[model samples]
Target: MRVKVDADKCEGHNRCCALAPELFDVDDYGTATALNDGNVPPELEEKAKLAVQNCPEYAIEFVKD
Candidate 1:
């Protein structure tokens, strides 16, 4: 699975980083960027999902490959 954040939809909440620090990076301005290329490691799958669910802007999405 691959995850991506929609810059247009994101409001820089940083919630994704809060939920999954290893999976996301939040800048000083609070723009959240996906880490590990948004590659969902098996151990981090659940946490990634939580991040997706908690995003207020619904900006995170997964691409199944």
Candidate 2:
């Protein structure tokens, strides 16, 4: 599965990065950005979902492609 992060909804919380550093990147201001083009590896799928679930803004989502 793939994932995508909503830049508009991100509020620099960094929770996503804290949960899954490999899947996310934190900006200078602490906003989270998905890594690897948000293309989650199978082994890391659960971590990706956890990051999405823990985001306070609910800015992360699975992409259907």
Give candidate 2's TM-score: 0.94
Model 1, C-alpha of 18: deviation from truth (Å): 0.5
lDDT for model 2 comes to 0.90
Worst 10 residues of 1 by lDDT: 27-36
Which clashing pairs does model 1 show?
Answer: none
Cα shift from native, residue 50, model 2 (Å): 0.3
Residues 1-65, candidate 1: write the lDDT tens digits.
77899888989988899899989998787888888788988999899999999999999999777
How accurate locally is residue 45 in candidate 1, as Cα lDDT from 0 to 100?
89
Clashes of 2: 0
Give the alpha carbon lDDT tens digit for every residue of 1-65 in model 2. 88899999999889889889999998897777889899998999999989989999999999997
Please tell me which predicted candidate would have the highest lDDT against the true structure. Answer: 2
